[model samples]
Target chain A: MELTGAQILIKLLKEEGVKTIFGYPGGVVIDIYDELMKSDIRHILVRHEQGAVHAADGYARASGGVGVCLVTSGPGATNTVTGIASAYMDSIPLVVFTGQVPVHLIGNDAFQEVDIVGITRPCTKHNFLVKRTEDLAKTVKEAFHIARSGRPGPVLVDIPKNVSVTKIKYKAPGPVKMRSYNPTCNPNKRQLQKVLELIKAAERPVIFAGGGVILSKAPEELTKLAKRTQIPVTTTLMGLGAFPGTDPLWLGMIGMHGTYRANMSTAHCDLFLSVGVRFDDRVTGKTDTFASQAKIVHIDIDPTSIRKNIPVTVPVVGDCKCTLEELNRMLEGVDLGDLDKKRKPWLDQIQAWKDTKPLAYEQKDIIKPQYVVEKLYELTEGKAIITTEVGQNQMWAAQYYHFDKPNHFITSGGLGVMGFGLPAAIGAQLACPDHIVVDVAGDGSIQMNIQEMATAVQCNLPVKVVILNNGYLGMVRQWQQLFYDKRYACTCMEHAPDFVKLAEAYGASGFRATKPEEVESVLKKGLSTPGPVIMDFVVEKEECVYPMVPAGAPITEMLLV
Target chain B: MLDADKHVLSILVENQPGVLSRISGLFSGRGFNIESLCVAVTTDPTVSRVTLVTKADQMIIEQIKKQLNKLINVIKVHELTGSPFVEREMVLIKVHAKPEHRAEILRTVDIFRCKVVDVGAEHYTIEVTGTEEKLDAILSLLKPIGIKEIARTGVIALFREPK
Candidate 1:
């Protein structure tokens, strides 16, 4: 049947099993939006174009499929840049559709014409501008394929206004196989043998997990390997849910703000089995001393991630799930005497470190931000899907909340994007309707895209936003206090809006907790509200995230508070 | 420690717009220096090959290749800096060649296997294609002849298969 480009887009999305889209339509995308109005595919009207993309990102993270979104031309297309870059940095799978000025007006600088493909080239995995109607289907197909395959990332497809109204002959296409883009999936047997040998022979072995394990859905395989070898597992900020956070072998997170045992174990381990981490600067401070004594084994789907930051003794380029599965299968037959007995001393040392310098914060006078996160964790029974905006709020949430499963803790790890949590919580709540979803946000970051609170109310997503009102840009303020002797440049947000009033204006219930006694009551009330709610807790203004390794300092030598 | 070394990088990429800008932008963004750059389409209509030379340490060399590989358009990257390779660069020199100085100019052109592509009343445009050193040597030999103008194509290289 001959169908308009908008009709074909709806058909394609349906064929791809996409049930919902987070978008804000404009003049150029009106046709697509009109078609959307009549389709069964629900469209969540986001308040801003950035929120649309980020909500889609959160949806994709919560659900293991390619997230989809739509936006308009000019400023609308440009507004999505931060979200696109954040998704790219974290390697999230997303396909963003943007409306463009009609084909003939693309270069004429027409009213709303912008070179979106050029703008997003550096960030997106791939992008396209469909000038003709016939190419729309294949481009859409290719965009989704590229977004989800190999190392996943965001892809954009810019459709002109005329193309949406043009007629096209549609024929469903099969899976795409780009000859130039095949990714290696299976780990090399020799490399697996080397990993096995190191694990068996090393007196102190530690497993460093990253986001790739969650992206590849390899938690079961990773758990099997960790259990079989009795190696302590520590995750990066993005890899929070790759292993059970409550496991005894779990050394907390590792990096600038990682736990004491996690950082110490990584610094002194004999063999470092790093699966899917890119050795980001934040994670491997002072590269020369990062795991200096260990024989580092790096396994990732992307070959470029290995040895790009730190040297690796054994590098395996393959899917995390595939590599871990094969490694576990191979280890099933190996006899390594009693693995737990051999690792006792190492585990004991790690336990001693954990006991020596446990993560602690003093809550006096004013309420602490960490206390809010800990209460949320306890109140939700460690089951609510937690998303966080960047800075002190994010680090505190990652530190206090223990996730027991994959896809539970979602945050912008690589990009450290503020204003991410509120919209992301909406997406997560939409993806898992039965589960409670909360955004642990800071006052400064929450205001960046505070408009998204309307989207939650409109969609009735029932996402709870827990704002730790610290009255400052907590992270940057901490840095200024530490490095610049408390100059307090522009990091203060002394006069912030009343969040409770803002929530009420958006037709959502709001609650505020000013003292320590009110934290739990406010949380309980907001969570049980059945509809979207915002809980604003007035937290300590001068609180600082602990276990900070100063810039250029080794991860081993942290300035623990 | 920035212990840098000169290395030649050959890459195969999609023959499309913005790719060159992306690669160059990456170099500038990462603070890696590019010594020379050249690009042209390969046998495949949809693909283009790029050649860029840069100076970097061993670690930075790996970084350059990995960053290049991360690009969606980049198909493959090959580092052929130390291998047995053949390189060619073409230079056109317009040197003053008076009637009395014709013999000397012709002799020099013959020795360099260069052709006098354009001949004016008092000048000759010599076109030479050879390795960078050979081109440099020819330019030196013609420099004292009151050279009027010169144009050169950036160097392109290929690995010389050993027997």
Candidate 2:
């Protein structure tokens, strides 16, 4: 059948089961917008291109599908770079489409034309510039396939304006057959047998999970392994919900700002069965000292990630879920020999460390940031999908909120991009309409993407923005105070717009609370509101996230409060 | 010097516009140095062979190979350093040849199995194709004759048949 490139794109999206797209239309993408109007796919018109990409990322994280976004060329494409980098760092599955100038006009400095394919080559899993109308369908198919396949990441396809309007004899492309792109999904049985042997013999073993577990959707298998072997589970920031946070074996997050018990356990463990983690520097602290006493068994789909940071004794190259399943099957027959009784001494030691330096803070007259997150978690019954911006607000949310399911807590863990939460909440809300979506943002982070509030209100997303208003960039301020000897520098933001008024101006409900007692009531009101709402809680200005390991220091050498 | 750190990689990639850039970009982005690189269309017109030379330790070499394999355009990466391979590099040397030195230069070229492709009134442009060590030996022998200029192609290689 004859169809325009734009129509073919829409049909292929439908074929791929894409029900929603976050995008912003511009001169080059007007044809795509016109074609989109004739389809049932929901198009969220974001205020900015960055918001569109972040929203798509959030939608993908919430729905466990490839997120799609569309934007114009030049500045629109450039604006999405930060968002694309963030998704790439976290391994979120996303397909970003940017409208380019015509094929003839390319490389001639045409209006709204930029080498987006070249610019994003480093960040995207793969990228393409569609020069012909006939290649659009196949390119789109390949983009989605690469984005959602093993070790998923964002992919970009730059479509010229002329291609969108050009007619083509359309046919659904065949399944992706790139011989060079096949990832190792099923692990070798012998390597997994070795891992099983290590697990059975180790006296103190810890399961270190990361974003790969969440990306591979192997939380169930991971939890099973941890439970069956009686190994304590410690997750990286991006792996927050991979294991139940409230479980007795949960060691909280492990790394720079990790729980004292988790870091201590990692330092002392004999075997580290790290599943799906890349061993990022933030998670490793001082690489030489990280898991020094442990025999690490690193299992990940990406072979390069296995020994790129810290060397491992056993490296299994395969998908996280498949490897875990194989390991679990192998464990079915082996006699673990009374795991709980064997692990009692290690568990008791961990418990002693936890009891000695539990995550705590003083609740003064001023509202502490941790108190707000705790209250929000309580009022929402721990069922809300929480997204956070960078710095103190993010750390506090990762600490206080206990996630009982995978993908419930979404944050920019690897890239730590500011202004990610608000729009991400919008995307999450749209993905799961009935779930409570909240952006646990700081005073500085909320202002970065404040324009997204308009997008939320227009869509009636009912996304609650809970701003921890400390009147400063709290994380940087804390660092300056601790290390720089009270040289605040530019971290202090004493003069800022009133968030409640700002929310009201965006045609959304607004509330505020100054005292500690009013925090709970304000959270309740804001979360219970019908449309989009913003709750501003004035928090203590100088409160710091404790147990911070100084840069380049060992994770065990933490400065506790 | 025959150093273990130096490696020759034979990579097969799709004959696309930016495949070379992507491979080179990967090297530069990761702080890996490309000592020499050459590309040409292979027996399959749609595929190109990129022979890249780099100096790195075993771990870094493993990382480079894995990273090269990760690119979608790259079909395969083979390390030819340890394998039985026939490698060749072409070099053209322009040496200053006075009338008195002409016989000596020609005799030296004859000994090295090189050809004096171009002859000027005062200089001779000699062309030679051989292994890196052979080319180096010829260039060093000709350098004492006051070589004017030189041009060299990147090293390229193919595996030899098993006996």
Candidate 3:
């Protein structure tokens, strides 16, 4: 059938089963917006281009589908860079469409023209420029396929203005050919056997689960392996919800800011089965000394990530779910003789370490960040899905909140992007409407994408945003105080808008928690509200994330409070 | 050390305007030296293809591959020393003959599978198609008599099977 480029785009999206899209229309992309008006897909008009992309990212993360966003070129395309990068780092699937200049004026630097393909190359899985009207259908189909395929990532399609206006006979192609892309989901049998052998032979075996476990939805298998082998599990910051934190075998997070017991146990374990984790610097403090006492077995989907950071004794490259299934099968017949006998001494040492320094917070007139996090944990009974913004709030959430299930604790660990929580909470709430989706956001990070409050209000998404107001970029201030001799340049914001007023302006219920006693009541009120609500908790300004291993120091050499 | 099947290549490079000098300088800088060298561009255009015959073993060929990857805008390069490939050369011979022996020479041309593209009263331009050795044989056959002019198309090759 003869179709315009815009109509072809709508048709392609319809074929892909896309029900909704988030974007803001401008000069170049009006053709798409006009075509969208004639289609059945729901288009959400966001306040800003950044908010649009973030909302799309949120939708993708929550729905487990490719998030679609359409925007004009130049600033609209440039504004989506942060959101695209966030998804790229986290390996979320997203398909972004950008309107380009006319074909004739492409090289002449026409109005609203930018080389988006070149700018986004490193941050995307793959990208294409639709020069011909006939290529639109194929490009759009391929974009979604590439974005949602194995090891998912964002893909951009830049459509020229004239191409969108041109008429062409469009028939959706079956599939395009890509020679270099291959994603393996099943573990090699020999490698799986080696991992099983390592797990069976080791006396003190610890399963270090990361975000991949949650991403692959392998929590049940992980829990089964942990219970069957009687091996304790320690999670990275991103891997928090992969196993129940309340389980006796759960050792909590292990990293620079991890629990004392968890960190020490990880350092001392004989066999470290690192599953679905990249061993980021935050997790492995000093590379030379990290897991020095352990023999490493790494399982990951990406082969390049196997020995990229830390050397692995046994490298099993495959999907976490498939690998764990194979492991469960291998362990079904093997008798783990007297598992308690092997773990008794190690458990005693770990308990002793936990007893030595439990996660503690001092109660003072000024509300400490940890105290607020602990109070939230107490009030929610550890049932709420907690999403965190970057910096101090994220670290506090990681330190205090106990996640009970997979998908319970979502944070931007690899990207460390601020302004992630509010939109992510919106997406999470949309995904699990019955559950309480709480975004633990810092004041600085909250303002980055606070406009998402509009999205929440429009959708009536019941997301409770708890803003930890410290009056400074708390994490940066801590860095400056510790390393930069307290210069404190640009770290402190003298005149900040009242968050309660900001929340009110966005048409959401607002509350303030000033004293320690008010923390619970304020959070309860915010959580009890029918729709989106914001609670501005006045937190201590100078408090920092303790147990910080001075950037390059060993994890053992932590500076605890 | 050259392989038993290795062949020597002779290439003509244009000496005009430091082009030949630049080409030689490039070869030496990249640790590749020419075994045989010749110069001059033909009448058609203001360009030249430098021909350098080298004794490149397999390892040396690999090194040359690496160096060629670094060159900016070098049109084309290939190793013409393998089987299952076709190689052809063209030679134009202007032979002096009397009118009486013209018929006999034309008959010889037909017997040798050559074409006379240009014919003057005294000289005939006979074009022969064959291997370099066969072309040399034809040139040797005409050496006893006067030969006016000669021109040749360089050895170009194509793989027998599709690449």
| DockQ, all candidates in order | 0.56, 0.77, 0.03
TM-score of 3: 0.77
lDDT winner among the candidates? Answer: 2
Candidate 1 colliding pairs: none
Those runs of model 3 whose alpha carbons end farther than 4 Å from true positions after fitting are A175-177, B1-163
CA displacement after TM-score superposition, residue A380 of candidate 1 (Å)? 0.3
Query: Which is the leading candidate under TM-score?
Result: 2
DockQ for candidate 1? 0.56
Mind giving the per-residue lDDT tens digits that candidate 3 earns over A1-561?
888989888888999999888888888889889999988898877777777767677777666677888999889999888888888777778899998998888878788888887777657766788889987887788788778765677888999988889988877787755433446789999988888888878987889999788778788999999999988999998789889988999887888788887888888999999999888898998898988889899998866566756877998878999999999998999988888887788788888888887777798998888988888899889988898999989999988898888777877778888988887787677667788889999999998888889988998888998888999999999888888999898988787788888878988889999998898899888889888899999988888888677787788786678
DockQ winner between 1 and 2, please give it.
2
Which residue ranges in model 2 land beyond 4 Å of their true spot?
B1-4
Candidate 1 wrongly placed segments (more than 4 Å):
B1-3, B95-106, B144-149
Interface RMSD of each: 1.8, 0.7, 13.1
Model 1 / residue B139 / CA error / Å: 2.9
> Cα deviation in Å at residue A31, candidate 1?
2.0
Can you write out model 2's per-residue Cα lDDT over A428-489, one digit (the tens) per residue? Answer: 99899999999999999988889999999999899999899899999999989989999999
Better of 1 and 2 by lDDT: 2
* Model 2 docking tier (incorrect/acceptable/medium/high): medium
Q: RMSD of candidate 1 to the true fold? A: 1.9
lDDT, residue A405, candidate 1: 93
